[model samples]
Target: MRILAADIGGTNSRFAVFRVGPGPLEREGGLTLPSAGATDFISLLERVWAGLGAGPEDFDAAVLAVAGPVRGRTCHPPNISWGIDLERDWPGPTPCLLLNDFLAQAYACRTPAVAEARVIQPGTADPRGAMAVIGAGTGLGHCALLPLERGFTAVPSEGGHASFAFVGPEEGAYEEFLRKETGRPYAYGDLVVTGSGLSLLHRFHTGRDLTPIQVAAELRPDSPTLDWFARFYARACRNYALTVLATGGLYVSGGLAAKNPTVVDNDHFRAEFINSPAHAELLRNLPVLLNANENSGLYGAALFGQRALEHATGLEA
Candidate 1:
Protein backbone atom coordinates (compact mmCIF):
# COMPACT_ATOMS: atom_id res chain seq x y z
CA MET A 1 0.00 0.00 0.00
CA ARG A 2 1.14 3.51 -0.79
CA ILE A 3 0.65 6.22 1.84
CA LEU A 4 0.91 9.94 1.28
CA ALA A 5 1.76 11.99 4.34
CA ALA A 6 2.11 15.72 4.80
CA ASP A 7 3.19 17.91 7.73
CA ILE A 8 1.96 21.43 7.21
CA GLY A 9 3.17 24.38 9.23
CA GLY A 10 2.52 28.09 8.99
CA THR A 11 5.79 28.71 7.16
CA ASN A 12 6.38 25.51 5.19
CA SER A 13 4.66 22.31 4.06
CA ARG A 14 6.44 18.98 3.59
CA PHE A 15 4.96 16.01 1.73
CA ALA A 16 6.33 12.50 1.35
CA VAL A 17 5.22 9.20 -0.16
CA PHE A 18 5.76 5.89 1.62
CA ARG A 19 5.35 2.28 0.52
CA VAL A 20 3.98 0.03 3.24
CA GLY A 21 4.82 -3.67 3.23
CA PRO A 22 5.02 -6.17 6.12
CA GLY A 23 7.37 -3.93 8.09
CA PRO A 24 7.73 -0.18 8.47
CA LEU A 25 7.10 1.84 5.33
CA GLU A 26 9.97 3.15 3.21
CA ARG A 27 9.90 6.89 2.65
CA GLU A 28 10.21 8.31 -0.82
CA GLY A 29 11.84 11.66 -1.38
CA GLY A 30 9.90 14.54 0.20
CA LEU A 31 9.12 17.94 -1.27
CA THR A 32 9.09 21.13 0.75
CA LEU A 33 6.89 24.02 -0.33
CA PRO A 34 6.90 27.48 1.12
CA SER A 35 3.62 28.77 2.47
CA ALA A 36 3.64 31.52 -0.16
CA GLY A 37 4.01 29.09 -3.07
CA ALA A 38 0.25 28.75 -3.50
CA THR A 39 -2.70 31.01 -3.07
CA ASP A 40 -4.72 28.23 -1.46
CA PHE A 41 -4.31 24.75 -0.01
CA ILE A 42 -5.78 22.98 -3.04
CA SER A 43 -3.26 24.65 -5.27
CA LEU A 44 -0.48 23.50 -2.97
CA LEU A 45 -1.80 19.95 -3.02
CA GLU A 46 -2.01 19.99 -6.78
CA ARG A 47 1.54 21.18 -7.06
CA VAL A 48 2.77 18.50 -4.65
CA TRP A 49 0.84 15.78 -6.48
CA ALA A 50 2.21 16.87 -9.83
CA GLY A 51 5.74 16.94 -8.48
CA LEU A 52 5.34 13.37 -7.23
CA GLY A 53 4.28 12.23 -10.73
CA ALA A 54 1.26 10.46 -9.28
CA GLY A 55 -2.44 10.94 -9.71
CA PRO A 56 -4.88 10.98 -6.84
CA GLU A 57 -5.86 7.34 -7.21
CA ASP A 58 -2.27 6.13 -6.92
CA PHE A 59 -2.35 6.31 -3.13
CA ASP A 60 -4.48 4.18 -0.87
CA ALA A 61 -4.29 6.29 2.27
CA ALA A 62 -3.38 9.81 3.40
CA VAL A 63 -2.64 11.70 6.59
CA LEU A 64 -2.29 15.43 7.15
CA ALA A 65 -0.72 16.87 10.29
CA VAL A 66 -2.05 20.37 10.46
CA ALA A 67 -0.97 23.27 12.66
CA GLY A 68 -4.51 24.16 13.65
CA PRO A 69 -7.53 22.67 15.36
CA VAL A 70 -9.35 20.02 13.31
CA ARG A 71 -13.05 20.66 13.66
CA GLY A 72 -15.14 17.98 11.94
CA ARG A 73 -13.63 17.75 8.42
CA THR A 74 -12.19 21.23 8.20
CA CYS A 75 -9.24 23.02 9.81
CA HIS A 76 -9.05 26.76 10.34
CA PRO A 77 -5.43 27.33 9.58
CA PRO A 78 -3.48 28.76 12.52
CA ASN A 79 -1.79 32.01 11.45
CA ILE A 80 -1.75 30.81 7.84
CA SER A 81 -3.70 32.52 5.09
CA TRP A 82 -5.28 29.33 3.74
CA GLY A 83 -7.94 27.11 5.29
CA ILE A 84 -8.30 23.34 4.69
CA ASP A 85 -11.50 21.45 3.95
CA LEU A 86 -10.60 17.79 3.53
CA GLU A 87 -14.00 16.59 2.36
CA ARG A 88 -14.37 19.24 -0.34
CA ASP A 89 -11.80 18.20 -2.94
CA TRP A 90 -10.01 15.05 -1.91
CA PRO A 91 -8.86 12.93 -4.82
CA GLY A 92 -10.57 9.68 -3.85
CA PRO A 93 -12.64 7.88 -1.22
CA THR A 94 -9.56 6.56 0.52
CA PRO A 95 -9.27 6.91 4.28
CA CYS A 96 -7.66 10.15 5.42
CA LEU A 97 -6.69 11.26 8.93
CA LEU A 98 -6.27 14.79 10.21
CA LEU A 99 -4.53 15.34 13.54
CA ASN A 100 -3.01 18.17 15.53
CA ASP A 101 0.61 18.76 14.58
CA PHE A 102 1.84 18.13 18.13
CA LEU A 103 -0.07 14.88 18.31
CA ALA A 104 1.72 13.79 15.16
CA GLN A 105 5.03 14.69 16.79
CA ALA A 106 4.10 12.59 19.81
CA TYR A 107 3.26 9.66 17.54
CA ALA A 108 6.71 10.00 15.98
CA CYS A 109 8.31 9.35 19.37
CA ARG A 110 7.46 5.66 18.98
CA THR A 111 10.24 5.31 16.45
CA PRO A 112 13.77 5.34 17.91
CA ALA A 113 16.96 6.37 16.12
CA VAL A 114 20.37 7.84 16.91
CA ALA A 115 20.10 11.60 16.71
CA GLU A 116 21.42 14.67 18.56
CA ALA A 117 18.69 14.88 21.21
CA ARG A 118 19.67 16.96 24.25
CA VAL A 119 19.06 15.73 27.78
CA ILE A 120 17.70 18.73 29.61
CA GLN A 121 16.99 16.78 32.77
CA PRO A 122 19.08 13.96 34.17
CA GLY A 123 16.60 11.49 35.62
CA THR A 124 15.28 7.98 35.18
CA ALA A 125 12.54 7.21 32.65
CA ASP A 126 9.94 4.67 33.65
CA PRO A 127 8.97 2.97 30.42
CA ARG A 128 5.60 1.93 31.84
CA GLY A 129 4.68 5.46 32.93
CA ALA A 130 3.28 8.49 31.12
CA MET A 131 5.34 11.01 29.13
CA ALA A 132 4.84 14.63 28.14
CA VAL A 133 5.75 16.03 24.69
CA ILE A 134 5.91 19.77 23.96
CA GLY A 135 6.97 21.84 21.00
CA ALA A 136 7.28 25.61 20.49
CA GLY A 137 6.82 26.54 16.87
CA THR A 138 4.10 28.43 14.96
CA GLY A 139 2.42 28.17 18.32
CA LEU A 140 2.95 26.17 21.43
CA GLY A 141 1.84 22.53 20.96
CA HIS A 142 1.57 19.84 23.64
CA CYS A 143 0.57 16.15 23.92
CA ALA A 144 1.01 13.16 26.16
CA LEU A 145 2.17 9.61 25.53
CA LEU A 146 0.56 6.94 27.68
CA PRO A 147 2.13 3.54 28.03
CA LEU A 148 -0.15 0.54 27.50
CA GLU A 149 0.39 -3.16 27.95
CA ARG A 150 1.10 -3.76 24.26
CA GLY A 151 2.61 -0.49 23.08
CA PHE A 152 2.01 3.24 23.58
CA THR A 153 -0.97 5.49 22.89
CA ALA A 154 -0.79 9.21 22.11
CA VAL A 155 -3.18 11.67 23.80
CA PRO A 156 -3.73 15.20 22.53
CA SER A 157 -3.63 17.96 25.16
CA GLU A 158 -4.26 21.69 25.44
CA GLY A 159 -1.65 22.16 28.15
CA GLY A 160 -0.15 24.94 26.15
CA HIS A 161 -2.93 27.29 27.21
CA ALA A 162 -2.78 26.40 30.86
CA SER A 163 -2.45 29.27 33.32
CA PHE A 164 1.06 30.39 34.05
CA ALA A 165 1.94 30.03 37.72
CA PHE A 166 4.35 32.49 39.28
CA VAL A 167 7.21 30.67 40.95
CA GLY A 168 8.43 33.43 43.26
CA PRO A 169 9.04 37.18 43.51
CA GLU A 170 11.15 37.22 40.37
CA GLU A 171 8.63 35.38 38.19
CA GLY A 172 5.86 37.48 39.66
CA ALA A 173 7.59 40.64 38.52
CA TYR A 174 8.07 39.18 35.07
CA GLU A 175 4.39 38.27 34.97
CA GLU A 176 3.46 41.86 35.74
CA PHE A 177 5.81 43.07 33.06
CA LEU A 178 4.21 40.70 30.57
CA ARG A 179 0.71 41.81 31.56
CA LYS A 180 1.55 45.45 31.06
CA GLU A 181 3.28 44.83 27.74
CA THR A 182 0.67 42.52 26.15
CA GLY A 183 -2.30 43.98 28.04
CA ARG A 184 -3.53 40.48 28.93
CA PRO A 185 -3.28 37.94 31.70
CA TYR A 186 -0.21 35.76 31.37
CA ALA A 187 -0.76 32.22 30.18
CA TYR A 188 1.84 29.48 30.53
CA GLY A 189 2.46 28.99 26.81
CA ASP A 190 1.66 32.54 25.78
CA LEU A 191 4.42 35.03 25.01
CA VAL A 192 6.91 33.46 27.39
CA VAL A 193 7.90 29.99 26.21
CA THR A 194 6.83 30.04 22.57
CA GLY A 195 8.96 31.12 19.61
CA SER A 196 7.18 34.42 19.72
CA GLY A 197 7.21 34.04 23.46
CA LEU A 198 10.99 33.99 23.56
CA SER A 199 11.08 36.98 21.30
CA LEU A 200 8.61 38.77 23.53
CA LEU A 201 10.73 38.09 26.56
CA HIS A 202 13.70 39.48 24.68
CA ARG A 203 11.74 42.56 23.75
CA PHE A 204 10.63 43.11 27.34
CA HIS A 205 14.22 42.93 28.47
CA THR A 206 15.72 45.05 25.70
CA GLY A 207 12.93 47.63 25.25
CA ARG A 208 12.74 46.66 21.57
CA ASP A 209 11.04 43.85 19.64
CA LEU A 210 13.02 41.44 17.52
CA THR A 211 12.04 38.51 15.37
CA PRO A 212 13.03 34.99 16.45
CA ILE A 213 15.78 34.97 13.82
CA GLN A 214 17.11 38.31 14.96
CA VAL A 215 16.96 37.29 18.62
CA ALA A 216 19.05 34.24 17.84
CA ALA A 217 21.67 36.41 16.21
CA GLU A 218 21.96 38.58 19.33
CA LEU A 219 21.74 35.83 21.98
CA ARG A 220 24.40 36.05 24.62
CA PRO A 221 24.84 33.75 27.62
CA ASP A 222 25.82 36.56 29.94
CA SER A 223 22.71 38.60 29.15
CA PRO A 224 20.57 38.69 32.30
CA THR A 225 17.26 38.70 30.42
CA LEU A 226 18.07 35.65 28.33
CA ASP A 227 19.26 33.90 31.47
CA TRP A 228 16.02 34.68 33.30
CA PHE A 229 13.85 33.57 30.35
CA ALA A 230 15.78 30.33 30.10
CA ARG A 231 15.02 29.65 33.75
CA PHE A 232 11.37 30.50 33.23
CA TYR A 233 11.14 28.24 30.22
CA ALA A 234 12.64 25.38 32.20
CA ARG A 235 10.24 26.11 35.01
CA ALA A 236 7.36 25.59 32.64
CA CYS A 237 8.76 22.21 31.68
CA ARG A 238 9.13 21.35 35.33
CA ASN A 239 5.55 22.33 36.01
CA TYR A 240 4.32 20.08 33.19
CA ALA A 241 6.47 17.21 34.41
CA LEU A 242 5.02 17.50 37.90
CA THR A 243 1.45 17.78 36.64
CA VAL A 244 1.60 14.56 34.59
CA LEU A 245 3.92 12.60 36.87
CA ALA A 246 5.85 12.17 33.66
CA THR A 247 8.27 9.57 34.92
CA GLY A 248 8.38 8.02 31.48
CA GLY A 249 10.21 11.19 30.37
CA LEU A 250 9.69 14.71 29.01
CA TYR A 251 10.48 15.10 25.33
CA VAL A 252 11.01 18.63 23.94
CA SER A 253 10.61 19.09 20.20
CA GLY A 254 10.13 22.28 18.19
CA GLY A 255 11.86 24.66 15.84
CA LEU A 256 12.88 27.11 18.57
CA ALA A 257 14.41 24.64 21.01
CA ALA A 258 15.92 22.45 18.27
CA LYS A 259 17.69 25.35 16.61
CA ASN A 260 18.98 27.06 19.75
CA PRO A 261 21.02 24.26 21.24
CA THR A 262 22.97 26.62 23.47
CA VAL A 263 19.88 27.93 25.24
CA VAL A 264 18.28 24.52 25.77
CA ASP A 265 21.51 22.76 26.79
CA ASN A 266 22.47 24.98 29.71
CA ASP A 267 22.59 24.30 33.43
CA HIS A 268 20.01 27.03 33.99
CA PHE A 269 17.31 25.05 32.17
CA ARG A 270 18.03 21.94 34.22
CA ALA A 271 18.20 23.94 37.42
CA GLU A 272 14.82 25.50 36.85
CA PHE A 273 13.42 22.13 35.77
CA ILE A 274 14.31 20.63 39.11
CA ASN A 275 13.22 23.61 41.19
CA SER A 276 9.90 22.32 42.47
CA PRO A 277 8.38 23.38 45.77
CA ALA A 278 7.40 20.10 47.43
CA HIS A 279 8.26 17.51 44.79
CA ALA A 280 11.72 18.78 44.12
CA GLU A 281 13.16 15.36 44.84
CA LEU A 282 10.76 13.66 42.45
CA LEU A 283 11.46 16.14 39.64
CA ARG A 284 15.20 15.94 40.14
CA ASN A 285 15.04 12.26 39.25
CA LEU A 286 12.69 12.62 36.26
CA PRO A 287 14.21 12.11 32.81
CA VAL A 288 13.98 14.73 30.09
CA LEU A 289 14.98 14.08 26.44
CA LEU A 290 14.85 16.38 23.43
CA ASN A 291 13.74 15.10 20.04
CA ALA A 292 16.68 15.49 17.69
CA ASN A 293 14.84 14.26 14.64
CA GLU A 294 13.69 17.13 12.41
CA ASN A 295 11.36 14.87 10.43
CA SER A 296 9.57 13.52 13.51
CA GLY A 297 6.26 15.03 12.48
CA LEU A 298 6.46 13.66 8.92
CA TYR A 299 7.39 10.18 10.18
CA GLY A 300 4.64 10.33 12.75
CA ALA A 301 2.05 11.41 10.18
CA ALA A 302 2.98 8.44 8.00
CA LEU A 303 2.80 6.14 11.03
CA PHE A 304 -0.62 7.53 11.90
CA GLY A 305 -1.84 6.88 8.37
CA GLN A 306 -0.48 3.33 8.46
CA ARG A 307 -2.10 2.51 11.78
CA ALA A 308 -5.36 4.13 10.75
CA LEU A 309 -5.41 1.90 7.67
CA GLU A 310 -4.72 -1.17 9.81
CA HIS A 311 -7.57 -0.35 12.16
CA ALA A 312 -9.99 0.19 9.32
CA THR A 313 -9.08 -3.20 7.79
CA GLY A 314 -9.14 -4.97 11.20
CA LEU A 315 -5.50 -5.93 10.76
CA GLU A 316 -3.09 -5.95 13.72
CA ALA A 317 0.56 -5.09 13.41
Candidate 2:
Protein backbone atom coordinates (compact mmCIF):
# COMPACT_ATOMS: atom_id res chain seq x y z
CA MET A 1 0.00 0.00 0.00
CA ARG A 2 1.20 3.51 -0.77
CA ILE A 3 0.79 5.67 2.36
CA LEU A 4 1.58 9.30 2.91
CA ALA A 5 2.34 10.04 6.56
CA ALA A 6 3.00 13.26 8.40
CA ASP A 7 4.22 13.74 11.95
CA ILE A 8 3.42 17.27 13.00
CA GLY A 9 4.97 18.59 16.18
CA GLY A 10 5.64 22.01 17.66
CA THR A 11 9.00 22.53 16.01
CA ASN A 12 8.88 20.55 12.79
CA SER A 13 6.46 18.88 10.41
CA ARG A 14 7.79 15.79 8.66
CA PHE A 15 6.11 14.15 5.67
CA ALA A 16 6.95 10.87 3.94
CA VAL A 17 5.63 8.50 1.32
CA PHE A 18 6.22 4.78 1.73
CA ARG A 19 5.15 1.39 0.46
CA VAL A 20 4.22 -1.18 3.14
CA GLY A 21 3.60 -4.92 2.88
CA PRO A 22 4.46 -7.86 5.16
CA GLY A 23 7.82 -6.17 5.71
CA PRO A 24 8.62 -2.69 6.98
CA LEU A 25 7.56 0.39 5.06
CA GLU A 26 10.01 1.41 2.32
CA ARG A 27 10.50 5.13 2.19
CA GLU A 28 10.03 6.73 -1.22
CA GLY A 29 10.76 10.32 -0.35
CA GLY A 30 10.32 12.58 2.70
CA LEU A 31 10.85 16.15 3.80
CA THR A 32 11.17 17.95 7.12
CA LEU A 33 9.93 21.51 7.21
CA PRO A 34 10.03 24.06 9.96
CA SER A 35 6.65 24.82 11.50
CA ALA A 36 7.47 28.52 11.87
CA GLY A 37 8.34 28.95 8.22
CA ALA A 38 4.97 27.90 6.86
CA THR A 39 2.13 30.42 6.50
CA ASP A 40 -0.25 27.70 7.56
CA PHE A 41 -0.63 23.92 7.54
CA ILE A 42 -2.36 23.86 4.16
CA SER A 43 0.50 25.80 2.63
CA LEU A 44 2.92 23.39 4.23
CA LEU A 45 1.07 20.44 2.74
CA GLU A 46 1.19 22.10 -0.66
CA ARG A 47 4.93 22.51 -0.31
CA VAL A 48 5.29 18.86 0.63
CA TRP A 49 3.22 17.72 -2.30
CA ALA A 50 5.19 19.88 -4.70
CA GLY A 51 8.52 18.78 -3.30
CA LEU A 52 7.56 15.11 -3.68
CA GLY A 53 6.32 15.65 -7.27
CA ALA A 54 3.02 14.14 -6.19
CA GLY A 55 -0.42 15.66 -5.91
CA PRO A 56 -3.07 15.11 -3.23
CA GLU A 57 -4.96 12.42 -5.11
CA ASP A 58 -1.87 10.31 -5.74
CA PHE A 59 -1.81 8.49 -2.38
CA ASP A 60 -4.02 5.57 -1.34
CA ALA A 61 -4.26 6.87 2.22
CA ALA A 62 -2.83 9.64 4.40
CA VAL A 63 -2.21 9.86 8.14
CA LEU A 64 -1.37 12.89 10.22
CA ALA A 65 -0.07 12.79 13.79
CA VAL A 66 -0.76 16.25 15.10
CA ALA A 67 0.45 17.87 18.31
CA GLY A 68 -2.96 18.62 19.80
CA PRO A 69 -6.39 17.22 20.55
CA VAL A 70 -8.63 16.10 17.68
CA ARG A 71 -12.37 16.56 18.19
CA GLY A 72 -14.17 14.89 15.28
CA ARG A 73 -12.57 16.32 12.11
CA THR A 74 -11.29 19.51 13.74
CA CYS A 75 -8.21 19.73 15.96
CA HIS A 76 -7.84 21.92 19.01
CA PRO A 77 -5.40 24.74 18.31
CA PRO A 78 -1.96 23.22 18.08
CA ASN A 79 0.41 24.35 20.75
CA ILE A 80 2.43 26.03 17.99
CA SER A 81 -0.36 27.42 15.83
CA TRP A 82 -4.10 27.97 15.35
CA GLY A 83 -6.12 24.75 15.00
CA ILE A 84 -5.71 22.74 11.77
CA ASP A 85 -8.81 21.04 10.36
CA LEU A 86 -7.38 18.10 8.41
CA GLU A 87 -10.52 16.94 6.61
CA ARG A 88 -11.46 20.40 5.44
CA ASP A 89 -8.02 21.75 4.57
CA TRP A 90 -6.21 18.70 3.21
CA PRO A 91 -4.89 18.95 -0.34
CA GLY A 92 -6.52 15.84 -1.81
CA PRO A 93 -9.73 13.85 -2.00
CA THR A 94 -8.15 10.66 -0.62
CA PRO A 95 -9.15 9.24 2.76
CA CYS A 96 -7.14 10.63 5.64
CA LEU A 97 -6.74 9.80 9.32
CA LEU A 98 -6.05 12.26 12.13
CA LEU A 99 -4.71 11.16 15.50
CA ASN A 100 -3.08 12.69 18.54
CA ASP A 101 0.69 12.40 18.11
CA PHE A 102 1.08 10.35 21.27
CA LEU A 103 -1.67 7.92 20.26
CA ALA A 104 0.16 7.44 16.99
CA GLN A 105 3.30 6.70 19.01
CA ALA A 106 1.33 4.04 20.93
CA TYR A 107 0.35 2.29 17.72
CA ALA A 108 4.01 2.30 16.70
CA CYS A 109 4.76 0.63 20.01
CA ARG A 110 2.93 -2.47 18.80
CA THR A 111 5.95 -3.17 16.65
CA PRO A 112 8.58 -2.27 19.24
CA ALA A 113 11.23 -4.51 17.72
CA VAL A 114 11.27 -2.49 14.52
CA ALA A 115 13.05 0.16 16.51
CA GLU A 116 15.60 -0.16 19.31
CA ALA A 117 13.31 0.86 22.21
CA ARG A 118 15.29 0.64 25.44
CA VAL A 119 13.89 -0.44 28.80
CA ILE A 120 14.66 2.15 31.48
CA GLN A 121 12.64 0.37 34.14
CA PRO A 122 11.93 -3.40 34.21
CA GLY A 123 8.37 -4.04 35.38
CA THR A 124 5.71 -6.48 34.27
CA ALA A 125 3.71 -5.14 31.33
CA ASP A 126 0.33 -6.88 31.34
CA PRO A 127 -0.27 -6.97 27.61
CA ARG A 128 -3.93 -7.46 28.51
CA GLY A 129 -4.13 -4.43 30.82
CA ALA A 130 -3.94 -0.71 30.28
CA MET A 131 -0.60 0.77 29.18
CA ALA A 132 0.42 4.41 29.37
CA VAL A 133 2.75 6.47 27.14
CA ILE A 134 4.10 9.90 28.14
CA GLY A 135 6.52 12.00 26.18
CA ALA A 136 8.08 15.44 26.80
CA GLY A 137 9.12 17.27 23.67
CA THR A 138 8.03 20.70 22.43
CA GLY A 139 5.25 20.02 24.94
CA LEU A 140 4.12 17.07 26.99
CA GLY A 141 1.99 14.44 25.25
CA HIS A 142 0.15 11.52 26.86
CA CYS A 143 -1.94 8.48 25.86
CA ALA A 144 -3.12 5.08 27.03
CA LEU A 145 -3.25 1.66 25.37
CA LEU A 146 -5.93 -0.90 26.10
CA PRO A 147 -5.68 -4.43 24.82
CA LEU A 148 -8.74 -5.84 23.08
CA GLU A 149 -9.29 -9.40 21.98
CA ARG A 150 -8.86 -8.38 18.37
CA GLY A 151 -6.01 -5.87 18.73
CA PHE A 152 -4.82 -2.96 20.86
CA THR A 153 -6.93 0.14 21.33
CA ALA A 154 -5.32 3.54 21.81
CA VAL A 155 -6.69 6.60 23.65
CA PRO A 156 -5.22 10.09 23.82
CA SER A 157 -5.04 12.15 27.03
CA GLU A 158 -4.59 15.74 28.14
CA GLY A 159 -3.03 14.65 31.41
CA GLY A 160 -0.04 16.91 30.85
CA HIS A 161 -2.24 19.86 31.78
CA ALA A 162 -3.32 18.35 35.09
CA SER A 163 -2.44 20.36 38.19
CA PHE A 164 1.09 19.91 39.44
CA ALA A 165 1.57 18.08 42.73
CA PHE A 166 4.65 18.49 44.89
CA VAL A 167 6.15 15.35 46.32
CA GLY A 168 9.08 17.06 48.01
CA PRO A 169 10.08 20.36 49.62
CA GLU A 170 12.07 21.47 46.57
CA GLU A 171 9.09 20.82 44.27
CA GLY A 172 6.78 22.75 46.60
CA ALA A 173 9.10 25.74 46.50
CA TYR A 174 9.46 25.39 42.74
CA GLU A 175 5.68 25.46 42.42
CA GLU A 176 5.49 28.73 44.32
CA PHE A 177 8.33 30.20 42.28
CA LEU A 178 6.60 29.28 39.02
CA ARG A 179 3.36 30.92 40.16
CA LYS A 180 5.27 34.14 40.76
CA GLU A 181 7.05 34.00 37.39
CA THR A 182 4.15 33.04 35.11
CA GLY A 183 1.39 34.80 37.07
CA ARG A 184 -0.68 31.68 36.49
CA PRO A 185 -1.32 28.38 38.20
CA TYR A 186 1.15 25.67 37.18
CA ALA A 187 0.72 21.97 36.87
CA TYR A 188 3.66 19.96 38.22
CA GLY A 189 4.23 18.21 34.92
CA ASP A 190 3.70 21.44 33.04
CA LEU A 191 6.22 23.32 35.22
CA VAL A 192 8.99 20.79 35.76
CA VAL A 193 9.05 18.01 33.20
CA THR A 194 8.49 19.63 29.79
CA GLY A 195 11.01 21.41 27.58
CA SER A 196 10.07 24.78 29.04
CA GLY A 197 9.65 23.17 32.41
CA LEU A 198 13.29 22.12 32.44
CA SER A 199 14.31 25.70 31.73
CA LEU A 200 12.07 26.92 34.53
CA LEU A 201 13.65 24.50 36.99
CA HIS A 202 17.13 25.51 35.86
CA ARG A 203 16.36 29.17 36.46
CA PHE A 204 14.88 28.41 39.87
CA HIS A 205 17.97 26.54 41.02
CA THR A 206 20.78 28.62 39.50
CA GLY A 207 19.21 32.06 39.40
CA ARG A 208 20.17 32.04 35.71
CA ASP A 209 17.51 32.06 33.02
CA LEU A 210 18.19 29.87 30.00
CA THR A 211 16.30 28.19 27.22
CA PRO A 212 15.64 24.43 27.37
CA ILE A 213 18.50 23.80 24.98
CA GLN A 214 20.84 25.92 27.04
CA VAL A 215 19.86 24.16 30.23
CA ALA A 216 20.48 20.82 28.56
CA ALA A 217 23.86 22.00 27.38
CA GLU A 218 24.80 23.09 30.89
CA LEU A 219 23.47 19.97 32.61
CA ARG A 220 26.01 17.96 34.60
CA PRO A 221 25.75 15.12 37.07
CA ASP A 222 27.10 17.26 39.90
CA SER A 223 24.87 20.26 39.19
CA PRO A 224 22.36 20.61 41.99
CA THR A 225 19.73 22.05 39.69
CA LEU A 226 19.98 19.18 37.22
CA ASP A 227 19.75 16.80 40.19
CA TRP A 228 16.52 18.43 41.28
CA PHE A 229 15.11 18.26 37.75
CA ALA A 230 15.84 14.55 37.65
CA ARG A 231 14.06 14.01 40.96
CA PHE A 232 10.91 15.85 39.96
CA TYR A 233 10.88 14.20 36.53
CA ALA A 234 11.11 10.73 38.05
CA ARG A 235 8.45 11.56 40.59
CA ALA A 236 6.11 12.71 37.83
CA CYS A 237 6.73 9.49 35.89
CA ARG A 238 6.02 7.40 38.98
CA ASN A 239 2.84 9.32 39.68
CA TYR A 240 1.63 8.74 36.13
CA ALA A 241 2.51 5.08 36.39
CA LEU A 242 0.47 4.63 39.56
CA THR A 243 -2.51 6.67 38.42
CA VAL A 244 -2.96 4.69 35.21
CA LEU A 245 -2.00 1.42 36.82
CA ALA A 246 0.42 1.12 33.93
CA THR A 247 1.27 -2.45 34.73
CA GLY A 248 1.60 -2.83 31.02
CA GLY A 249 4.70 -0.72 31.72
CA LEU A 250 5.43 2.95 31.06
CA TYR A 251 6.95 4.04 27.77
CA VAL A 252 8.70 7.42 27.79
CA SER A 253 9.45 8.96 24.40
CA GLY A 254 10.27 12.44 23.05
CA GLY A 255 13.31 14.64 22.64
CA LEU A 256 13.63 15.68 26.29
CA ALA A 257 13.89 12.23 27.91
CA ALA A 258 15.67 10.56 25.01
CA LYS A 259 18.52 13.08 25.03
CA ASN A 260 19.00 13.00 28.80
CA PRO A 261 19.80 9.42 29.68
CA THR A 262 21.69 10.68 32.72
CA VAL A 263 18.42 11.57 34.43
CA VAL A 264 16.97 8.12 33.86
CA ASP A 265 20.12 6.41 35.11
CA ASN A 266 20.45 8.37 38.35
CA ASP A 267 19.56 6.83 41.71
CA HIS A 268 17.25 9.75 42.44
CA PHE A 269 15.28 8.95 39.27
CA ARG A 270 14.60 5.36 40.28
CA ALA A 271 13.88 6.25 43.94
CA GLU A 272 11.30 8.83 42.96
CA PHE A 273 9.77 6.53 40.37
CA ILE A 274 9.09 3.85 42.98
CA ASN A 275 7.90 6.16 45.77
CA SER A 276 4.26 5.20 45.97
CA PRO A 277 2.42 5.89 49.23
CA ALA A 278 0.88 2.51 50.03
CA HIS A 279 1.48 0.17 47.15
CA ALA A 280 5.12 0.95 46.63
CA GLU A 281 5.62 -2.62 45.52
CA LEU A 282 3.23 -2.23 42.63
CA LEU A 283 4.83 0.98 41.42
CA ARG A 284 8.34 -0.29 42.02
CA ASN A 285 7.91 -3.34 39.85
CA LEU A 286 6.34 -1.70 36.83
CA PRO A 287 8.74 -1.55 33.91
CA VAL A 288 9.68 1.79 32.41
CA LEU A 289 10.93 1.88 28.80
CA LEU A 290 12.48 4.64 26.75
CA ASN A 291 11.72 4.76 23.04
CA ALA A 292 15.11 5.23 21.41
CA ASN A 293 13.74 5.41 17.90
CA GLU A 294 14.14 8.80 16.23
CA ASN A 295 11.40 8.17 13.67
CA SER A 296 8.87 6.89 16.18
CA GLY A 297 6.29 9.53 15.35
CA LEU A 298 6.68 8.94 11.62
CA TYR A 299 6.35 5.19 12.03
CA GLY A 300 3.35 5.86 14.22
CA ALA A 301 1.70 8.02 11.58
CA ALA A 302 2.08 5.22 9.07
CA LEU A 303 0.58 2.72 11.48
CA PHE A 304 -2.36 5.03 12.08
CA GLY A 305 -2.96 5.26 8.35
CA GLN A 306 -2.85 1.49 7.97
CA ARG A 307 -5.17 0.88 10.91
CA ALA A 308 -7.71 3.45 9.81
CA LEU A 309 -7.78 1.99 6.30
CA GLU A 310 -8.38 -1.48 7.68
CA HIS A 311 -11.23 -0.25 9.86
CA ALA A 312 -12.90 1.56 6.98
CA THR A 313 -12.65 -1.28 4.48
CA GLY A 314 -13.00 -4.18 6.96
CA LEU A 315 -9.83 -5.68 5.48
CA GLU A 316 -6.73 -6.43 7.53
CA ALA A 317 -3.44 -5.54 5.84
lDDT of 1 by residue, 231-295 (tens): 86787777777777898888888777778766667878887888867988888888788786767
* C-alpha RMSD values across all candidates: 2.7, 2.4
Over 4 Å off in model 1, which ranges?
A: 113-116, 168-170, 183-185, 313-317
Clashing pairs in 2: 121-288, 123-286, 123-287, 164-187, 164-188
Per-prediction TM-score to the true structure, in the order listed: 0.90, 0.92
Candidate 2 C-alpha lDDT tens digits along 1-317: 88888888887788888776767667787888887778787888878878899976888888888888887666764467656886578765787777788887787787642267777777777777778788887877788888888888888987777776775686678789989988876664655678888888888888998988888888888987678777777777777777777888888887787787676667778887887679789877788888866567888888777666656762222
Candidate 2: segments with Cα more than 4 A from true spot: 112-114, 313-317
lDDT agreement of model 2 with the native: 0.77
